[model samples]
Target: MISVKNLYHSYNKDGKYQVKDVSFEVANGEVFGFLGPSGAGKSTALNILTGLLPLQQGEVVVGGYDLKKVSNERFNKIGMSFEQSNVYSKLTAKENLDFYRKLFDVPTLDSHALLKLVGLEGKEHVKAGEFSKGMKHRLTFARSMINNPEMWFLDEPTTGLDPSIAADIKDIIKEKNKEGVTVFLTTHNMFIADELCDRVAFIVDGEIKLIDSPKNLKLQYGDKLVEVEYMEKGEVIKTTLSTVLPEDKRELQKIIEHHDIQTMHTKEATLEEIFIKVTGRGLV
Candidate 1:
């Protein structure tokens, strides 16, 4: 559904590139994440792909249209939710959606239903200026769906949301993907990427370092060991056994038979840890 090849962009004629020779693809009905910290050029790449930024070099194709030659009608198939709220502060939640529905030339959307879906059902009549940051974020999220777009571009979708609300948004994203909407998510939040993305690209300093499924990346970077916690002499002790160890099976059996096991788990690298290890920089 989306493709980028050797993409590069710079804000100034001689300035350093904001996005440098980055390339990746997102299949139909797939959720692809661009994971990076602020100033990592993830947003720059997204903007270029969405036709917000003029292409400087390379190819970017979305919905079968080249980024360099995309028409205004291309927006009909795309929806975007930015990190900052872009709705009018004076408009009510329902009004905000209503405005976007008309702006997008989408007459089939139910503005009230969209608001309700985002957890602002009763607050539909309240002006957005009075809403909390989380409320504004939810409203913007709902606005993005006003067009019932074929593809979604979400930047920090759950930025200001509480746990419950964030979970709700994530669930909605999953449902959309299941319904065949391709998702391009950009965020520094590894947990969100791990939960929603089918595959993720690690971007730093305007370049993509790696692209792979989270599960695959975990397996590639994680240890092949099992950690066992046991209680002995009123004290808790833990030991790790490499799965490849010559006596691993016998040792595990002995520990199970002689010790009171408290807990056991396999050691695996988290997406955040893997990113740190690969990029040599924190997500911030």
Candidate 2:
């Protein structure tokens, strides 16, 4: 549903480019993530894809139309939810979605049903201005689905949300993907990306440093050792063993047989740790 090749964009002539030779593709029904820290050009890339910014260099096609030549009809197939909530403050939750439903000029789900999808069913009568931050975020997510868009663009969809709300949002995203909606998610939250994305691209300093499934990246960068923790004497003791060595297996067997085990698990690298290893910088 989306494709880009050698994409590049700059804010001003002779100024540094915000996106540099970035390239990727999002297949229909795929949950693709653009993972990066602040100042990593993630938003810049998303803006170009959504036609919010002019495409200055490289080709981008979203939903079968070239971005530079994207028409209103083509844009109607896309949905966007930004990190910052953009609902009308004075409008009630139902009123807000109703307005956008008309803007799309297409058959849409009932406003109440939309609200219910995002866990705002009974709060439909509440004015957005009176809603809490997390509630407003939920409303914004509902608004994005007003038109039942074929391609969804979510930027930090769960930012500032409590754990329960975040989980609800993630479940909604999964539900959409199950129905064949292509999702392009941009966020620095490694755990979310790992849980939801089919594949992820890691961007840093305006360049893509890595692109792979979360599981693959972890195995590629993780250590090949398992750590065993046990209670020895009056204190807890920990030891590392090579996962592939026969001697290490014997040592672990001895520990398991003689010690009161507390915990034993493989030492796997997290996405954040792998990001740091590849880019030599932490997420800001």
Candidate 3:
């Protein structure tokens, strides 16, 4: 659904670039995550794709139209939600979405349904300025779907929301993806990327370090170990045993047979750990 090759962007006219030599593709119905820390050029790349920033160099195509000469019809197939909420403060939640609905030439989703979908049913009549930060964020999310877009560009969609609300947002993204919306998600949150993305690209200092499915990445970089918490005497003991070693496996077998096991699970590398290992820096 989207393709970018050798993408580059610079804030100033200087030779240094914010986004450099970036390239990736998003399948028709895939959730492709662009993962990075602050100032790692995730936003710079996203802005270029969404047309917020002009294309400074390289090639980018969305829905088969080259960004260098893409027409307005192409944008109608795209939707975007930023980390910061961008809504008309004086307008009501319903009004905010209704206003955006008119911007598209294609058929749009119902404002009321979108508002309710994002947990803003009652707030339909409430002014956006009166709503809390979370409320405004939810409103922005609903507004993005106003066009019923095929390509969804989300920037930190659930960044500051509480767990419950974030879960709702994730569910909605999943639902949309099931309905064939191609999502380009930019985030620093490992959990979100691991949960929602079919594949992720790790970007650091404007260059991509790696791109792979979370499961594949974990298997490639994960430690061959199992973590166990079991009752020993009057207290609980927690330990890690190497899965690759015969001695540790035997000891783990003994624990399973004799001790009351409280919990036992494989100790695999998390996405954050893998990112750190690859880039020599944390997501931050």
User: Which predicted model would earn the best TM-score?
Assistant: 3
Error of 1 at 52 (Å): 1.4
lDDT of all predictions: 0.91, 0.91, 0.93
Q: What is the TM-score of each predicted model, taking all chains together? A: 0.96, 0.95, 0.97
Off by over 4 Å in 1: 247-249
lDDT by residue for model 1 (1-284), tens: 99999998899957689898998989999999999999999999989888888988999899888878859988988999999988899888888887777767545469888888999989989999999999999989998888899989998898868999999999999999999999999999999999999999999999999999999999998768889999889899999988767798689889899999999998877899999999999999
Q: Which lDDT value does model 1 have at 249?
A: 67
Best by lDDT: 3
For candidate 1, the per-residue lDDT at 279 reads 96
In model 2, the clashing pairs are none
Q: Estimate candidate 2's RMSD in Å.
A: 1.5
Cα deviation of 258, candidate 1, in Å: 1.5
lDDT tens readout by residue for model 2, 93-206 = 999998888887678879999888888989988999999999999999988888889999999999899999999999999999999999999999999999999999999988
Inter-residue clash pairs, candidate 3: none
